[model samples]
Target chain A: MDKKLEPIVKTMQEKFSAAHEEFRGEVHVFVNPEQIVDALTVLRDEYKFELLSALTAVDYYPQTSPRFHVVYQLTSLANNVSVQVRVPVDGDSPKVPTAARVYATANWRERELLDMFGIEFEGHPDPRRILMPEETEGHPLRKDFPLGYEEPQFTFNFEEIDLRKPYVKE
Target chain B: MGVEQKLGNMGVVTTTLENMVNWSRTNAMWPMLFGLACCAIEMMSAQAPHYDMSRFGMELMRASPRQSDLMIVAGRVSKKMGPVLRRLYDQMPEPKWVIAMGDCASCGGVFNNYAIYQGVDEVVPVDVYVAGCPPRPEALIHGVLTVHEKVKAQKLKDLAKS
Candidate 1:
């Protein structure tokens, strides 16, 4: 863990009951999905972790207990340090409390997470898909989502494919 | 009297109306001023001073579809952009042509996925396909010449059908 972030991590762990682990000097603090907003608030207002660098979700499809880990990366310009906050969300329909209130940048980032991972954000001012086409059926970034490959037409299959290929007509 | 001296004031040359019409159409096949992705850069290069597409009578790239006769689909077509392409193609006047200007616009190139449409042909009828990741300006010129060849070959009766 970064030496500068030690006391801040200690405060977050002690006060919010956030458990933290360090990998090669970078620190990640885990908090409950519901308590994420409060944890981010305390880190921002008190510890000066002002910038919300990123907000994204990681999918663990087969693991139903905690299927998704919503990641929030915070950067403190004043203290010259960064910390990552992770919220483990469980079940098929994972829901996380909106962090938009605490960090203004979280608005679009959370919308992207919602679009790609289908993770619902409680109290999100506008809960709409940010990237994909409006009528796009599934969250494309999910593990179970289809790779969306189309079979390439090689010489052997060209004539066969051409016979059925839907070319636009006059 | 010599032939030149006798025919100084008047001369008679004969050609069919069909030949005249096709000749004019091939000369002034104004392409639409539009581009989608990276290939658009190459398309611009083809128009620029270095390669100069003006000699081919395509210097005027019209912004309005109603006035244009050719659409050089310059790059990949995303699913969101497919409908707009079709709408523009429909708005173009009769006897218009389409040149799918790159591998991406031709047969999806490397983007065989959900977001990008498999190929632009699924949206609008393509006349010539210049195959390249982003084809060289020479290749685009070649494609234009091919369209001219096609237009020249058309019979007068065929013009009525379009």
Candidate 2:
């Protein structure tokens, strides 16, 4: 609610007039995915929202349109303020531009976003799984992934196999 | 003379021997570092300065199974981690104790997902079950004390037999 940000809001409202408005900030406006990178570059260079606190995607599957939403939370540590920007994308191709140029911390968060949600960061330096093993199929944290797939492959036969017997090679 | 020296000089042979045994056992309770999830945070907190667990002499947390005498299963054991956990239990030396430190560790709490192992006791022999989503630090301390009591009882039984 700073007096200075009044003109910035006016400028966003004037320029991206057709963009679907989800939320607004002291000086910023959340725009569609088409204008997200442009809006971010403006905020970083012109408006000084210099820190990207966190970035992640929320999947809203089975929906007819906009099946995934990428959330970008940026901050101005010096000013102690934050703004959340969400961009809805198609489930088939979840792609977004990397914010590494804007804030260095987005490098890892972008990679996690790609690995976990299957979102592609267009210019991400290293997009890879952060938690799950590379061999692990499907994102385990997703709502749809089955909990325990099948019966275990191994078990002990404590009764049948005699521990008392001398060791013998199989 | 110090209290320990006075106790030694007083000719209380049985009590002195018991104290000596307890002192050594309490000082060397090597706990297995098994952090499964969020409850691991509470486990870390209990180890921090405010709790000062070193006072009762059980602050060493060993990563390897061979060296540890106490296994603190600090969070939910997922189906994936179950076999690995069992392997660790088997690796520990005999006379080792297992502490199921949370509701999840005792009986797979809120994460009733098929992925979670219902109860760790189904796999390993649990000596103490500290019941809570994440048990308070005092509860963990009580669980350790209970383990100490059990150890003392076993020692006394061994002495009686000898």
Candidate 3:
């Protein structure tokens, strides 16, 4: 955490004071769906947080209000500082603005987040499955999914492996 | 029935050739190192010190398909990587062995999702399947021993042919 980023942090805190009253220092203001892309753009162009290292989601199921938390970790190579931004969303129609325009790297990361947490990246160019198949019914990373599912083993012929054998008693 | 008769009646050269084959098979088992996911860490651990797999004669890890004799599919294989896995298997030299290292590689572990190839054996022929979430180092050693036994049996049969 450098002294130079203090102004950027303060500006962000002041701008989104309404939506993000629970803002901390290193873990910056966690905004809602509406301001996500704008905030990311400002962070990148204005503040020089050039690298969007990782975008992932954490499922908070069985809870009342927010069912998922999407986390975006950004790093500024010039300043050598990092910040984490989180946005909580409802499971039924979870949606967030795409950061693809701000950073090209967010394309696959957002798709993966969608695949695992079922969160929608609104306005994303090509939102598709990255890990799971296209027709996969449920997100396997979800806690609700069973870890181990029992199924029938594939049958194989054993007699084919015994071609050269003739019983020779010792 | 004494030493004189045993020396004179050395018939088929069975014992000598069988011993040589067993030694060669055990000495050089070149495993094709396949790292698919997280369990690859443990596979790497098995290769590193403390568990020093070099002692049992399987420390040589070949990156190329032509040179390697064994393939250790160390983690979960995604649907995308399935064809690649099969292609690598096809490229390897004959008389090759495959070891399915983790729960993911053996079977699709925690991911029952459509993306994963349920088990690597679905793509390639696996000789020994080491069982664990990521099988313990000792369990991997056991799988190595199992492969050794299969190799020894094959060698003896080959010797019997000549």
Native contact fraction per model: 0.59, 0.14, 0.08
Tens-digit lDDT string for candidate 3 (A108-146): 998998888778888899989987667777776777765
User: Which candidate achieves the best TM-score against the true structure?
Assistant: 1
Instruction: Flag clash pairs in model 3.
Output: none
User: If the candidates were sorted by their DockQ against the true structure, best first, what order would they fall in?
Assistant: 1, 2, 3
Q: What lDDT is reached at residue A142 by model 3?
A: 70
Poorest lDDT segment (10 consecutive residues) of candidate 2 chain A: A161-170
Query: Candidate 2 on B1-162: residue-level lDDT in tens?
Result: 136567666644345666666656766788887788877888888889998677777788888999999999889887568778889989998668888898988767777665676668767878888999789988888898898887765555565674
Q: Which sections of candidate 2 miss by over 4 Å?
A: A1-6, A9-35, A77-83, A140-143, A146-170, B1-28, B33-65, B76-91, B113-118, B121-125, B148-162
Clashes per candidate, residues 3 or more apart or on different chains:
0, 0, 0
lDDT of each: 0.88, 0.72, 0.76
Best by DockQ: 1
**Candidate 3 displacement at residue B159 in angstroms:** 12
**For model 1, what is the alpha-carbon lDDT of residue B63?**
97
Each prediction's TM-score against the native?
0.88, 0.66, 0.61
User: Candidates' DockQ values?
Assistant: 0.50, 0.10, 0.10
Question: Per-residue lDDT of B5-34 in model 1, one digit per residue for the tens?
Answer: 477765654578887788899888899999
**Model 3 interface DockQ:** 0.10
| Residue pairs with clashing backbones, model 1 | none
Supply candidate 2's per-residue lDDT for B143: 91
